[model samples]
Target: MKTTGSPAGTGETAGSEANGAGGAPLRLWGGRFAGGPAEALAKLSVSVHFDWRLAPYDLLASKAHARVLYRAELLDDAELAAMLGALDDVGADVAAGRFTATIEDEDVHTALERALVERLGTLGGKLRAGRSRNDQVATDLRLYLRAAVRQVAAVLTELSEALVDVAEEHVATPAPGMTHLQHAQPISFGHQILAHVHAFARDVDRLRDWDRRAAVCALGAGALAGSSLPLDPEGVAAELGFDRAFANSIDAVSDRDFAAEFLFAAAMIGVHLSRLGEEIVLWTSREFGWVELDDAFATGSSIMPQKKNPDVGELARGKSGRLIGALTGLLATLKGLPLAYDRDLQEDKEPVFDAVDTLLVVLPAVTGTVATMKVRTERVAAAAPDGFSLATDVAEYLVRRGVPFRSAHEAVGALVAWCVEHDADLGEVSDAQLAAINPAFTPDVRDVLSVAGALDARSAPGGTAPARVREQIANLRPTLAADHKWAVG
Candidate 1:
């Protein structure tokens, strides 16, 4: 498709009115109309407030586009040099917070373009020769998310390392592992914490994988069809640190799958964090008494003197909903639209931005919580042996003694029922009671009934046995190091 110009002339003619002087329109497309947009419409349409955060990426895309224009012979060497110098000025101003978007500047693109023209006159206008806001914003968003993915990944790595540190401290500490909110078996607390670390590790993997797709540049996908000029999109992509350029102009500007994938990753992170948060909440309660929140990461009730609430965990839980909303909202906005760009697409950034901002705050706060909070080892150990937690070990012992698992399971179930009825623990059951349940009863059966014995019995790979946990911890150290390198870089 051919690029369209303003009704009065090229985009340059619309640039003056976009400067917020007199009663002129606030948009770059104002030249196509006789009058300005209504106040309500302008207010609703403007995105410079939230999108101004994308200015740096916008400037980066502009610089690369200037080089492309120069190669296309649309910009002479002097003009190119002047444009680059002017972009530097604009970037510096933005970096210093001296340059900002005015109400008339509808978005980051128009705002920065106006800043450029203000600095370099017509040379600034030449930067738009073969570009469109459609492709420009697409390119800018990709660059922004690419950097954000790395940043989020880095923070995730820190969280994973924090978990590893805590896990290392408790590799031999036994705790009651639960399923369906009931004690199922004994496990090392380290193994339990590493379960979360593994989930976060997958999150980092998703972010890295998503970056590969997000790396494709969208600059040369002018308005709709490819640019008419002999633009080198691949060269611009390389300059912008992308792996390649868009193969289809329409898809480049319109596809928001990368953003959706990012939100999904963010939401999954929230889900994982919320699970951690929930455990923190439970562990800190009088019921569990497994952990205590650090004062720095906790908050007090408004009127209660004895309340130190796990606010960080609670917020992480609440923000998971927000992250889910972001993904759902963006998907709704992108639903059923025809190929090519639309103003509805403008609705994409805010939700994803909120997701990123939410994660940035939540990750570090949760990390601090995990790092500083006291683990009530004595309490965890005490609770580990209560609630018939050793029942499973008895069943497993019978399995090793040649009893079929189903038979062993039935025997253990009966034993558990007998203990519950008698208000006694398996450790309290006598040899006669053991033999009454099964002929396999022997004095050695009591050996596997203790928490430590149960834990040691699970010495297989990925088990909660002390040796296995220590081995997993050692293996995780190098994995954390490798993930940290990729995340930070």
Candidate 2:
């Protein structure tokens, strides 16, 4: 490569700069100008490094657009066939790493056009007639993100199933449920794990809902004005598997709402994983002593011979901030842009790609973590009854035995105060102490004070009682199956 530019810092013009003997910059846009873009602008304008990930999607759109060109008589039958063949070859080479974008190529669209031109000569140049990189890139991203959304959704399914399996295996396992970081009640351990599963189910649902909005094709919205050629945008949309063609050309090219929505969904998935990770970290801690990580999932510290760190859980927690930053960064990039596309729109792909990449890697590791971790049931059961967690059951039991709810609540509060003052467990109060607390605190209150009694007392639908937990799983499996089917679609 050769170039003559206003020197790097001299502020001279490089309008006539050439990067090759032919004096062209190996770009798609130089024909309109005498020389090339300034080296500074050229270097800054290049997006192939990140946008190259869109190469396969770009080529797919190009193939669809070529058919549109042929139908419009812009290209003859033989030309369309040649164009499709060239695109297929380029796709294969790209997949195999034999063909790749160069920095001078500017972006995926340009680099791909360069490939086509090299393969088919002037026949390739004919392919660009009724489209612009604005529409092409927009369409490519929709295609790419739609697929990425499904990929993320599928992995979410994996994590969700991992959680469901754990839930089923431990439906009878008792654990302390907390509010404000303090023990609130005893709940089925399965119930706690299934709660995470439900959050991930919503993530999959969010992606599916987003896909409906993102399924429109943007190809014929060339450069933000509808193409003037006899274009069958709807036909092209059908060919490309889009739900429909763009109704508004400007909106089509400039709308990054889909990308933002996806990052939001990805960020939310990160948040759910962070919460699950947070709990995993807590459970595996010596202070909690409720869970132990599988050897493969736990990490050893360099200096501490006894360290078994929850590195995977910690990474899941930390990466949530990264995912959220991707969403916010795109919103900032998009906030001031007017109708139609701008170079700032070029910033969209990296965040979208990174979020997709991040989740695909994170979900599998977290799934493995959930699937393999060991719960210390004895410790969990012991902790279940600590901190006066059974107090709520005592209050409910009083309510059932003809005590006014508020009076029963007061009676239970005094009993708890007595227990706290005397350093006694809720179940340790004898009938003499019950009479001392209140007459409503009958001898039978001791029955509900048991951990299993506290768990089974709330046996209505959606309760943590073992039977209800099993029923919940029975209902949840079909929903997960439906979710998996929709996600893979």
Q: List the residue pairs that clash in candidate 1.
A: none
RMSD of 2: 5.7
lDDT of each structure? 0.86, 0.86
Clashes of 2: 0
> How much does candidate 2 score in TM-score?
0.94
Taking all chains together, each candidate's TM-score versus the true structure is: 0.95, 0.94
Q: Write the per-residue lDDT of candidate 1 for residues 1-489, one digit (tens) a residue.
A: 111112222234434533445745335666557677788998998998899999999999999999999999998877788778778878888888778887777899988887776666555667888889999999999999988888898898899999999999998898989999898888899999999998998999888889888999999999989877999999999999999999999999998999999999999999999999999999999989889888899999889989989998899899999999999999988888988898999998999889889999999999999999999999998888878888888888899999999999998899889988999888888999888877786879888888998889899888899899889888888877887788777
- Among all windows of 10 consecutive residues in model 2, the one with the lowest summed lDDT is 1-10
For residues 92-189, could you state the per-residue lDDT of candidate 2 as single tens digits?
Answer: 88888888777778888877776776666656678888899999988999999998888888889988898999999889988999999999999999
Span of 10 residues, lowest total lDDT, candidate 1:
1-10
- RMSD to the true structure for each prediction, in A, is 4.4, 5.7
